[model samples]
Target: MEISRRRFSALGAGVAATTLSGTLSGATAAQAETPPGKPAVRNVVLVHGAYADGSSWAKVIPLLQEAGMNVTAVQNPLTSLADDVAATNFALARQDGPTLLVAHSYGGTVISEAGLAPNVTGLVYVAARAPEAGEDFAALSARFPTPPVTSGIITSGGFKWIGRSAFLRDFANGVPRKEALVLYAAQGLLSTAAPTTSVAAWREKPSWYAVSKDDRTINPDLERFMARRMNATTIEVDSGHLSLVTHPKIIAGLILRAAANS
Candidate 1:
Protein backbone atom coordinates (compact mmCIF):
# COMPACT_ATOMS: atom_id res chain seq x y z
CA MET A 1 0.00 0.00 0.00
CA GLU A 2 2.82 2.40 0.83
CA ILE A 3 4.56 1.71 -2.49
CA SER A 4 1.36 2.31 -4.48
CA ARG A 5 0.65 5.57 -2.59
CA ARG A 6 4.15 6.87 -3.35
CA ARG A 7 3.72 6.17 -7.08
CA PHE A 8 0.39 8.04 -7.16
CA SER A 9 1.90 11.03 -5.39
CA ALA A 10 4.78 11.14 -7.88
CA LEU A 11 2.40 11.00 -10.84
CA GLY A 12 0.27 13.82 -9.46
CA ALA A 13 3.32 16.04 -8.90
CA GLY A 14 4.55 15.47 -12.45
CA VAL A 15 1.14 16.36 -13.92
CA ALA A 16 0.93 19.53 -11.85
CA ALA A 17 4.43 20.55 -12.89
CA THR A 18 3.58 20.08 -16.56
CA THR A 19 0.48 22.22 -16.22
CA LEU A 20 2.36 25.00 -14.44
CA SER A 21 5.10 24.96 -17.06
CA GLY A 22 2.59 25.17 -19.91
CA THR A 23 0.79 28.08 -18.28
CA LEU A 24 4.00 30.01 -17.81
CA SER A 25 5.03 29.34 -21.41
CA GLY A 26 1.70 30.61 -22.65
CA ALA A 27 1.99 33.78 -20.61
CA THR A 28 5.49 34.37 -21.87
CA ALA A 29 4.46 33.85 -25.49
CA ALA A 30 1.58 36.29 -25.20
CA GLN A 31 3.68 38.89 -23.49
CA ALA A 32 6.38 38.48 -26.07
CA GLU A 33 3.97 39.63 -28.79
CA THR A 34 3.30 42.94 -27.07
CA PRO A 35 5.84 45.62 -27.79
CA PRO A 36 7.46 47.34 -24.78
CA GLY A 37 5.52 50.24 -23.20
CA LYS A 38 2.30 48.81 -24.60
CA PRO A 39 0.39 46.90 -21.93
CA ALA A 40 -1.19 43.86 -23.54
CA VAL A 41 -4.92 43.76 -24.10
CA ARG A 42 -5.15 40.37 -25.77
CA ASN A 43 -8.76 39.98 -26.82
CA VAL A 44 -10.75 42.14 -29.22
CA VAL A 45 -14.49 41.90 -30.02
CA LEU A 46 -15.60 43.67 -33.19
CA VAL A 47 -19.28 44.52 -33.58
CA HIS A 48 -20.65 45.39 -37.02
CA GLY A 49 -23.52 47.81 -37.37
CA ALA A 50 -26.61 48.02 -39.54
CA TYR A 51 -26.43 46.91 -43.15
CA ALA A 52 -23.44 44.72 -42.48
CA ASP A 53 -22.45 41.36 -41.03
CA GLY A 54 -19.19 40.00 -39.62
CA SER A 55 -17.69 40.04 -43.11
CA SER A 56 -17.70 43.81 -42.93
CA TRP A 57 -14.54 43.51 -40.89
CA ALA A 58 -12.75 41.19 -43.34
CA LYS A 59 -9.87 43.56 -43.92
CA VAL A 60 -9.42 44.58 -40.30
CA ILE A 61 -9.53 41.05 -38.88
CA PRO A 62 -6.28 39.84 -40.42
CA LEU A 63 -4.47 42.93 -39.23
CA LEU A 64 -5.53 42.41 -35.63
CA GLN A 65 -4.80 38.67 -35.83
CA GLU A 66 -1.36 39.25 -37.29
CA ALA A 67 -0.48 41.33 -34.24
CA GLY A 68 -1.01 38.18 -32.13
CA MET A 69 -4.35 39.15 -30.63
CA ASN A 70 -7.43 36.94 -30.49
CA VAL A 71 -10.15 38.81 -32.38
CA THR A 72 -13.85 38.03 -32.86
CA ALA A 73 -16.05 39.84 -35.32
CA VAL A 74 -19.65 39.59 -34.11
CA GLN A 75 -22.44 38.70 -36.53
CA ASN A 76 -25.29 40.62 -35.00
CA PRO A 77 -28.80 39.82 -36.13
CA LEU A 78 -29.94 43.37 -36.75
CA THR A 79 -33.49 42.55 -35.74
CA SER A 80 -33.36 44.98 -32.81
CA LEU A 81 -30.92 46.76 -30.57
CA ALA A 82 -31.36 44.19 -27.82
CA ASP A 83 -30.69 41.33 -30.21
CA ASP A 84 -27.46 42.86 -31.42
CA VAL A 85 -26.32 43.54 -27.89
CA ALA A 86 -27.00 39.93 -26.99
CA ALA A 87 -24.88 38.75 -29.88
CA THR A 88 -22.01 41.03 -28.86
CA ASN A 89 -22.29 39.90 -25.24
CA PHE A 90 -22.13 36.31 -26.44
CA ALA A 91 -18.77 37.07 -28.07
CA LEU A 92 -17.54 39.07 -25.09
CA ALA A 93 -18.41 36.25 -22.74
CA ARG A 94 -16.12 33.93 -24.66
CA GLN A 95 -13.04 36.14 -24.31
CA ASP A 96 -10.43 34.91 -21.82
CA GLY A 97 -9.28 38.23 -20.37
CA PRO A 98 -9.41 41.99 -20.75
CA THR A 99 -10.98 42.79 -24.12
CA LEU A 100 -11.27 45.79 -26.42
CA LEU A 101 -14.83 46.25 -27.69
CA VAL A 102 -14.82 47.81 -31.17
CA ALA A 103 -17.87 48.78 -33.19
CA HIS A 104 -18.86 50.35 -36.51
CA SER A 105 -21.96 52.28 -37.61
CA TYR A 106 -25.07 51.26 -35.60
CA GLY A 107 -22.82 48.76 -33.84
CA GLY A 108 -21.79 51.63 -31.58
CA THR A 109 -25.09 51.27 -29.75
CA VAL A 110 -24.47 47.54 -29.32
CA ILE A 111 -21.00 47.93 -27.81
CA SER A 112 -22.29 50.73 -25.60
CA GLU A 113 -24.76 48.31 -24.05
CA ALA A 114 -22.59 45.20 -24.14
CA GLY A 115 -19.39 46.97 -23.11
CA LEU A 116 -20.87 47.10 -19.63
CA ALA A 117 -19.69 43.49 -19.35
CA PRO A 118 -16.86 43.24 -16.82
CA ASN A 119 -14.34 41.76 -19.26
CA VAL A 120 -14.56 44.75 -21.58
CA THR A 121 -11.66 47.10 -20.81
CA GLY A 122 -12.23 49.69 -23.52
CA LEU A 123 -14.54 50.77 -26.32
CA VAL A 124 -13.53 51.82 -29.85
CA TYR A 125 -16.01 53.38 -32.22
CA VAL A 126 -15.28 53.53 -35.96
CA ALA A 127 -17.70 55.81 -37.72
CA ALA A 128 -20.30 54.46 -35.29
CA ARG A 129 -23.28 56.04 -33.58
CA ALA A 130 -22.79 56.98 -29.91
CA PRO A 131 -26.06 58.29 -28.57
CA GLU A 132 -26.79 59.17 -24.96
CA ALA A 133 -28.82 56.51 -23.17
CA GLY A 134 -32.49 56.81 -24.13
CA GLU A 135 -31.61 59.71 -26.42
CA ASP A 136 -33.33 59.76 -29.79
CA PHE A 137 -30.58 58.73 -32.18
CA ALA A 138 -32.74 59.36 -35.23
CA ALA A 139 -33.63 62.81 -34.01
CA LEU A 140 -30.00 63.42 -33.17
CA SER A 141 -28.88 62.44 -36.67
CA ALA A 142 -31.73 64.49 -38.09
CA ARG A 143 -30.22 67.51 -36.36
CA PHE A 144 -27.31 66.95 -38.73
CA PRO A 145 -27.97 66.99 -42.46
CA THR A 146 -29.66 63.70 -43.31
CA PRO A 147 -27.02 61.56 -44.98
CA PRO A 148 -27.42 60.94 -48.70
CA VAL A 149 -27.57 57.19 -48.10
CA THR A 150 -30.83 57.62 -46.21
CA SER A 151 -32.57 57.97 -49.55
CA GLY A 152 -31.50 54.48 -50.58
CA ILE A 153 -32.86 52.49 -47.64
CA ILE A 154 -35.44 49.94 -48.72
CA THR A 155 -37.64 48.30 -46.12
CA SER A 156 -39.72 45.15 -46.18
CA GLY A 157 -40.95 42.92 -43.35
CA GLY A 158 -39.55 45.44 -40.81
CA PHE A 159 -35.97 44.88 -42.02
CA LYS A 160 -33.96 47.49 -43.93
CA TRP A 161 -31.18 47.50 -46.50
CA ILE A 162 -29.50 50.24 -48.47
CA GLY A 163 -30.04 49.44 -52.14
CA ARG A 164 -27.01 48.60 -54.28
CA SER A 165 -26.83 52.07 -55.81
CA ALA A 166 -26.56 53.85 -52.50
CA PHE A 167 -24.29 51.18 -51.01
CA LEU A 168 -21.88 51.42 -53.95
CA ARG A 169 -21.88 55.19 -54.29
CA ASP A 170 -22.31 56.39 -50.71
CA PHE A 171 -21.55 53.57 -48.25
CA ALA A 172 -18.71 52.02 -50.23
CA ASN A 173 -17.35 55.00 -52.12
CA GLY A 174 -13.71 54.39 -51.32
CA VAL A 175 -13.83 50.59 -51.46
CA PRO A 176 -12.74 48.70 -54.57
CA ARG A 177 -15.69 47.84 -56.84
CA LYS A 178 -15.24 44.05 -56.67
CA GLU A 179 -15.03 44.05 -52.90
CA ALA A 180 -17.82 46.59 -52.57
CA LEU A 181 -20.17 44.33 -54.51
CA VAL A 182 -19.56 41.50 -52.05
CA LEU A 183 -20.26 43.84 -49.14
CA TYR A 184 -23.52 45.00 -50.74
CA ALA A 185 -24.67 41.44 -51.30
CA ALA A 186 -23.86 40.42 -47.76
CA GLN A 187 -25.11 43.47 -45.87
CA GLY A 188 -27.27 42.82 -42.84
CA LEU A 189 -30.91 43.76 -42.93
CA LEU A 190 -31.24 46.30 -40.15
CA SER A 191 -34.31 47.26 -38.18
CA THR A 192 -35.86 50.39 -39.56
CA ALA A 193 -36.15 51.98 -36.13
CA ALA A 194 -33.00 53.22 -34.47
CA PRO A 195 -33.48 52.21 -30.87
CA THR A 196 -31.62 54.01 -28.06
CA THR A 197 -29.58 52.23 -25.48
CA SER A 198 -30.55 52.08 -21.83
CA VAL A 199 -27.00 52.83 -20.75
CA ALA A 200 -23.99 54.09 -22.63
CA ALA A 201 -20.91 52.17 -21.52
CA TRP A 202 -18.60 54.88 -22.83
CA ARG A 203 -19.98 56.94 -19.99
CA GLU A 204 -17.41 55.29 -17.72
CA LYS A 205 -15.18 53.03 -19.80
CA PRO A 206 -12.03 54.30 -21.54
CA SER A 207 -12.70 54.86 -25.26
CA TRP A 208 -11.29 55.67 -28.68
CA TYR A 209 -12.94 56.74 -31.94
CA ALA A 210 -12.15 56.83 -35.65
CA VAL A 211 -14.05 59.32 -37.71
CA SER A 212 -14.25 58.75 -41.48
CA LYS A 213 -13.82 62.13 -43.11
CA ASP A 214 -15.85 61.40 -46.24
CA ASP A 215 -18.53 59.26 -44.60
CA ARG A 216 -21.87 59.47 -46.36
CA THR A 217 -23.66 56.70 -44.46
CA ILE A 218 -23.40 58.56 -41.17
CA ASN A 219 -22.56 62.23 -40.81
CA PRO A 220 -18.91 62.83 -39.96
CA ASP A 221 -19.92 65.76 -37.75
CA LEU A 222 -22.14 63.47 -35.71
CA GLU A 223 -19.31 60.99 -35.24
CA ARG A 224 -17.05 63.84 -34.16
CA PHE A 225 -19.70 65.18 -31.80
CA MET A 226 -20.16 61.79 -30.17
CA ALA A 227 -16.42 61.27 -29.86
CA ARG A 228 -16.03 64.70 -28.28
CA ARG A 229 -19.02 64.11 -26.03
CA MET A 230 -17.48 60.87 -24.76
CA ASN A 231 -14.06 62.49 -24.49
CA ALA A 232 -12.70 59.66 -26.63
CA THR A 233 -9.23 59.64 -28.16
CA THR A 234 -10.08 60.38 -31.78
CA ILE A 235 -8.47 60.06 -35.21
CA GLU A 236 -9.82 61.04 -38.60
CA VAL A 237 -9.33 58.77 -41.62
CA ASP A 238 -9.68 60.25 -45.10
CA SER A 239 -12.08 57.61 -46.40
CA GLY A 240 -15.76 57.12 -46.89
CA HIS A 241 -18.09 55.10 -44.65
CA LEU A 242 -16.33 51.84 -45.52
CA SER A 243 -13.05 52.95 -44.02
CA LEU A 244 -12.64 49.55 -42.45
CA VAL A 245 -12.43 48.13 -45.96
CA THR A 246 -10.39 50.86 -47.65
CA HIS A 247 -8.31 52.08 -44.68
CA PRO A 248 -7.84 48.93 -42.65
CA LYS A 249 -4.29 49.69 -41.56
CA ILE A 250 -5.34 52.94 -39.88
CA ILE A 251 -8.27 51.21 -38.24
CA ALA A 252 -6.01 48.39 -37.07
CA GLY A 253 -3.56 50.91 -35.63
CA LEU A 254 -6.34 52.68 -33.73
CA ILE A 255 -7.56 49.36 -32.35
CA LEU A 256 -4.03 48.33 -31.36
CA ARG A 257 -3.63 51.61 -29.51
CA ALA A 258 -6.88 50.88 -27.67
CA ALA A 259 -5.65 47.40 -26.83
CA ALA A 260 -2.39 48.77 -25.45
CA ASN A 261 -4.19 51.28 -23.26
CA SER A 262 -6.83 48.84 -22.08
Candidate 2:
Protein backbone atom coordinates (compact mmCIF):
# COMPACT_ATOMS: atom_id res chain seq x y z
CA MET A 1 0.00 0.00 0.00
CA GLU A 2 1.18 3.50 -0.72
CA ILE A 3 1.89 5.75 2.25
CA SER A 4 0.19 9.12 2.51
CA ARG A 5 2.32 12.06 1.42
CA ARG A 6 2.82 13.35 4.96
CA ARG A 7 3.76 9.91 6.20
CA PHE A 8 6.09 9.46 3.26
CA SER A 9 8.04 12.57 4.23
CA ALA A 10 8.36 11.32 7.80
CA LEU A 11 9.46 7.89 6.64
CA GLY A 12 11.96 9.54 4.34
CA ALA A 13 13.46 11.51 7.18
CA GLY A 14 13.71 8.44 9.41
CA VAL A 15 15.27 6.38 6.63
CA ALA A 16 17.57 9.29 5.76
CA ALA A 17 18.90 9.23 9.31
CA THR A 18 19.49 5.49 9.22
CA THR A 19 21.32 5.71 5.88
CA LEU A 20 23.58 8.71 6.60
CA SER A 21 24.54 8.23 10.26
CA GLY A 22 27.53 6.15 9.24
CA THR A 23 29.13 8.94 7.24
CA LEU A 24 28.15 11.79 9.54
CA SER A 25 30.65 10.80 12.24
CA GLY A 26 33.65 11.12 9.96
CA ALA A 27 32.22 13.86 7.80
CA THR A 28 35.29 16.03 7.76
CA ALA A 29 37.59 13.17 6.96
CA ALA A 30 35.30 11.86 4.22
CA GLN A 31 34.89 15.30 2.67
CA ALA A 32 38.59 16.07 2.69
CA GLU A 33 39.50 12.87 0.89
CA THR A 34 39.33 12.94 -2.89
CA PRO A 35 36.70 10.67 -4.41
CA PRO A 36 38.41 7.51 -5.56
CA GLY A 37 39.00 8.01 -9.30
CA LYS A 38 36.87 6.22 -11.90
CA PRO A 39 36.03 3.31 -9.61
CA ALA A 40 38.13 2.07 -6.74
CA VAL A 41 35.70 -0.82 -6.68
CA ARG A 42 33.44 -1.88 -9.57
CA ASN A 43 30.11 -1.40 -7.83
CA VAL A 44 28.20 -1.88 -4.61
CA VAL A 45 24.84 -3.62 -4.90
CA LEU A 46 22.43 -3.00 -2.01
CA VAL A 47 19.61 -5.43 -1.24
CA HIS A 48 16.76 -4.50 1.08
CA GLY A 49 15.13 -7.20 3.18
CA ALA A 50 11.50 -7.81 3.95
CA TYR A 51 8.88 -5.12 4.76
CA ALA A 52 10.74 -2.56 2.63
CA ASP A 53 12.08 -1.95 -0.86
CA GLY A 54 14.85 -0.06 -2.71
CA SER A 55 13.96 3.25 -1.12
CA SER A 56 15.47 1.89 2.06
CA TRP A 57 18.92 2.73 0.73
CA ALA A 58 18.09 6.21 -0.53
CA LYS A 59 19.98 7.92 2.27
CA VAL A 60 23.17 5.95 1.83
CA ILE A 61 23.50 6.27 -1.96
CA PRO A 62 25.03 9.74 -1.97
CA LEU A 63 27.70 8.74 0.52
CA LEU A 64 28.82 5.86 -1.68
CA GLN A 65 28.80 8.10 -4.73
CA GLU A 66 30.78 10.78 -2.91
CA ALA A 67 33.45 8.15 -2.36
CA GLY A 68 33.52 7.55 -6.14
CA MET A 69 31.86 4.18 -5.89
CA ASN A 70 29.09 3.15 -8.26
CA VAL A 71 26.04 1.80 -6.44
CA THR A 72 22.94 -0.18 -7.38
CA ALA A 73 20.11 -0.75 -4.96
CA VAL A 74 18.34 -3.91 -6.06
CA GLN A 75 14.60 -3.65 -5.86
CA ASN A 76 13.87 -7.20 -4.76
CA PRO A 77 10.44 -8.48 -5.73
CA LEU A 78 10.21 -10.24 -2.35
CA THR A 79 8.31 -13.09 -3.98
CA SER A 80 10.61 -16.01 -3.08
CA LEU A 81 14.08 -16.39 -1.62
CA ALA A 82 15.60 -17.86 -4.75
CA ASP A 83 13.96 -15.25 -6.92
CA ASP A 84 15.46 -12.50 -4.84
CA VAL A 85 18.89 -14.12 -5.08
CA ALA A 86 18.61 -14.42 -8.83
CA ALA A 87 17.62 -10.79 -9.09
CA THR A 88 20.63 -9.82 -7.01
CA ASN A 89 22.95 -12.04 -8.99
CA PHE A 90 21.65 -10.47 -12.19
CA ALA A 91 22.68 -7.11 -10.79
CA LEU A 92 26.07 -8.47 -9.82
CA ALA A 93 26.60 -9.92 -13.31
CA ARG A 94 26.25 -6.47 -14.86
CA GLN A 95 29.03 -4.89 -12.80
CA ASP A 96 32.76 -5.08 -13.60
CA GLY A 97 35.69 -5.87 -11.28
CA PRO A 98 35.09 -6.61 -7.57
CA THR A 99 31.68 -5.87 -6.06
CA LEU A 100 30.35 -5.52 -2.54
CA LEU A 101 26.96 -7.09 -1.88
CA VAL A 102 25.05 -5.56 1.04
CA ALA A 103 21.80 -6.81 2.54
CA HIS A 104 19.41 -5.62 5.22
CA SER A 105 16.95 -7.59 7.38
CA TYR A 106 15.70 -10.62 5.36
CA GLY A 107 17.83 -9.38 2.50
CA GLY A 108 20.79 -11.01 4.28
CA THR A 109 19.49 -14.44 3.36
CA VAL A 110 19.32 -13.33 -0.26
CA ILE A 111 22.94 -12.14 -0.22
CA SER A 112 24.04 -15.29 1.59
CA GLU A 113 22.96 -17.20 -1.51
CA ALA A 114 23.50 -14.66 -4.32
CA GLY A 115 26.91 -13.67 -2.94
CA LEU A 116 28.21 -16.78 -4.63
CA ALA A 117 28.28 -14.59 -7.74
CA PRO A 118 31.70 -14.72 -9.39
CA ASN A 119 32.18 -10.95 -9.24
CA VAL A 120 31.37 -10.51 -5.56
CA THR A 121 34.37 -9.39 -3.52
CA GLY A 122 32.64 -8.96 -0.17
CA LEU A 123 29.33 -9.19 1.67
CA VAL A 124 27.87 -6.79 4.26
CA TYR A 125 24.85 -7.24 6.48
CA VAL A 126 23.04 -4.27 8.05
CA ALA A 127 20.99 -5.56 10.93
CA ALA A 128 20.26 -8.51 8.61
CA ARG A 129 19.54 -12.20 8.84
CA ALA A 130 22.43 -14.58 8.04
CA PRO A 131 20.97 -18.07 7.91
CA GLU A 132 22.71 -21.42 7.87
CA ALA A 133 21.90 -24.49 5.78
CA GLY A 134 18.26 -25.57 5.67
CA GLU A 135 17.27 -22.73 7.95
CA ASP A 136 14.21 -20.71 7.01
CA PHE A 137 13.05 -17.53 8.70
CA ALA A 138 10.42 -19.37 10.75
CA ALA A 139 12.89 -21.98 11.97
CA LEU A 140 15.30 -19.27 13.04
CA SER A 141 12.58 -17.23 14.69
CA ALA A 142 11.35 -20.36 16.48
CA ARG A 143 14.77 -20.81 18.07
CA PHE A 144 14.21 -17.50 19.83
CA PRO A 145 11.01 -16.63 21.61
CA THR A 146 8.77 -14.64 19.24
CA PRO A 147 9.45 -10.95 19.75
CA PRO A 148 6.21 -9.28 20.85
CA VAL A 149 5.79 -7.44 17.52
CA THR A 150 6.29 -10.47 15.27
CA SER A 151 3.92 -12.56 17.34
CA GLY A 152 1.12 -10.47 15.94
CA ILE A 153 1.58 -10.81 12.10
CA ILE A 154 -0.81 -13.69 11.31
CA THR A 155 -0.44 -15.81 8.21
CA SER A 156 -3.54 -17.58 7.00
CA GLY A 157 -2.14 -19.60 4.10
CA GLY A 158 1.08 -21.53 4.03
CA PHE A 159 4.01 -19.11 3.74
CA LYS A 160 1.88 -16.03 3.12
CA TRP A 161 2.36 -13.15 5.58
CA ILE A 162 0.87 -9.88 6.79
CA GLY A 163 2.12 -7.24 9.19
CA ARG A 164 0.11 -6.15 12.20
CA SER A 165 0.35 -2.94 14.23
CA ALA A 166 3.25 -4.61 15.94
CA PHE A 167 5.18 -3.77 12.79
CA LEU A 168 5.16 -0.24 14.20
CA ARG A 169 5.80 -1.50 17.72
CA ASP A 170 8.86 -3.57 16.95
CA PHE A 171 10.56 -2.66 13.66
CA ALA A 172 9.96 1.04 14.05
CA ASN A 173 10.13 1.46 17.82
CA GLY A 174 13.01 3.90 18.07
CA VAL A 175 11.93 5.75 14.91
CA PRO A 176 10.04 9.00 15.47
CA ARG A 177 6.35 8.42 16.17
CA LYS A 178 5.22 10.10 12.95
CA GLU A 179 7.88 8.36 10.86
CA ALA A 180 7.10 5.01 12.44
CA LEU A 181 3.50 5.50 11.43
CA VAL A 182 4.65 6.20 7.87
CA LEU A 183 6.83 3.10 7.89
CA TYR A 184 3.99 1.02 9.27
CA ALA A 185 1.70 2.38 6.58
CA ALA A 186 4.19 1.86 3.73
CA GLN A 187 5.66 -1.50 4.81
CA GLY A 188 5.44 -4.29 2.26
CA LEU A 189 3.61 -7.58 2.63
CA LEU A 190 6.36 -10.20 2.64
CA SER A 191 6.06 -13.80 1.55
CA THR A 192 6.67 -16.42 4.21
CA ALA A 193 8.58 -18.18 1.42
CA ALA A 194 11.04 -15.29 1.18
CA PRO A 195 12.66 -15.88 4.58
CA THR A 196 13.50 -19.55 4.01
CA THR A 197 16.92 -20.19 2.51
CA SER A 198 17.92 -23.52 1.01
CA VAL A 199 21.63 -23.41 1.82
CA ALA A 200 24.25 -21.37 3.68
CA ALA A 201 25.72 -18.76 1.32
CA TRP A 202 28.30 -16.89 3.41
CA ARG A 203 30.60 -19.90 3.98
CA GLU A 204 32.67 -18.97 0.95
CA LYS A 205 32.53 -15.17 1.07
CA PRO A 206 34.34 -12.57 3.19
CA SER A 207 31.60 -10.87 5.19
CA TRP A 208 30.75 -8.18 7.74
CA TYR A 209 27.70 -7.26 9.83
CA ALA A 210 26.19 -4.20 11.54
CA VAL A 211 24.17 -5.22 14.56
CA SER A 212 21.49 -2.97 15.98
CA LYS A 213 21.65 -3.67 19.67
CA ASP A 214 18.03 -2.77 20.27
CA ASP A 215 16.55 -4.39 17.18
CA ARG A 216 13.16 -5.92 17.91
CA THR A 217 12.17 -7.63 14.67
CA ILE A 218 15.19 -9.96 14.51
CA ASN A 219 16.79 -10.43 17.88
CA PRO A 220 20.17 -8.70 18.30
CA ASP A 221 21.45 -11.94 19.85
CA LEU A 222 20.62 -13.72 16.59
CA GLU A 223 22.66 -11.10 14.70
CA ARG A 224 25.69 -11.69 16.95
CA PHE A 225 25.19 -15.45 16.71
CA MET A 226 25.20 -15.33 12.91
CA ALA A 227 28.11 -12.88 12.75
CA ARG A 228 30.21 -15.17 14.90
CA ARG A 229 29.34 -18.17 12.77
CA MET A 230 30.28 -16.32 9.58
CA ASN A 231 33.47 -15.04 11.19
CA ALA A 232 32.35 -11.65 10.00
CA THR A 233 33.81 -8.27 10.97
CA THR A 234 31.23 -6.77 13.30
CA ILE A 235 30.06 -3.31 14.36
CA GLU A 236 27.24 -2.62 16.81
CA VAL A 237 24.86 0.30 16.31
CA ASP A 238 22.47 1.40 19.02
CA SER A 239 19.40 1.48 16.80
CA GLY A 240 16.25 -0.45 15.98
CA HIS A 241 15.26 -2.84 13.17
CA LEU A 242 15.72 -0.28 10.39
CA SER A 243 19.26 0.54 11.40
CA LEU A 244 20.30 1.33 7.83
CA VAL A 245 17.81 4.18 7.82
CA THR A 246 18.50 5.19 11.41
CA HIS A 247 22.31 5.02 11.23
CA PRO A 248 23.33 5.32 7.57
CA LYS A 249 26.76 6.81 8.20
CA ILE A 250 27.82 3.87 10.34
CA ILE A 251 26.47 1.54 7.72
CA ALA A 252 28.21 3.51 4.94
CA GLY A 253 31.51 3.48 6.80
CA LEU A 254 31.26 -0.27 7.14
CA ILE A 255 30.45 -0.55 3.44
CA LEU A 256 33.35 1.74 2.55
CA ARG A 257 35.66 -0.33 4.75
CA ALA A 258 34.44 -3.51 3.08
CA ALA A 259 34.99 -1.90 -0.31
CA ALA A 260 38.50 -0.82 0.64
CA ASN A 261 39.39 -4.28 1.92
CA SER A 262 37.86 -6.00 -1.08
Give me the candidate number with maximum TM-score.
1
Q: TM-score for every candidate vs. truth?
A: 0.85, 0.81
How high is the lDDT of residue 225 in model 2?
83
Which lDDT value does model 1 have at 154? 93
Candidate 1 lDDT over residue span 59-136, tens digit each:
889878877789999999898988888888899889998999999999999998888899999999999998888889
Candidate 2, residues 76-158, lDDT tens digits: the string is: 88777777888898889889778999999989989988887888888989888898867766676688766666666777554
Model 2, total clashes? 16
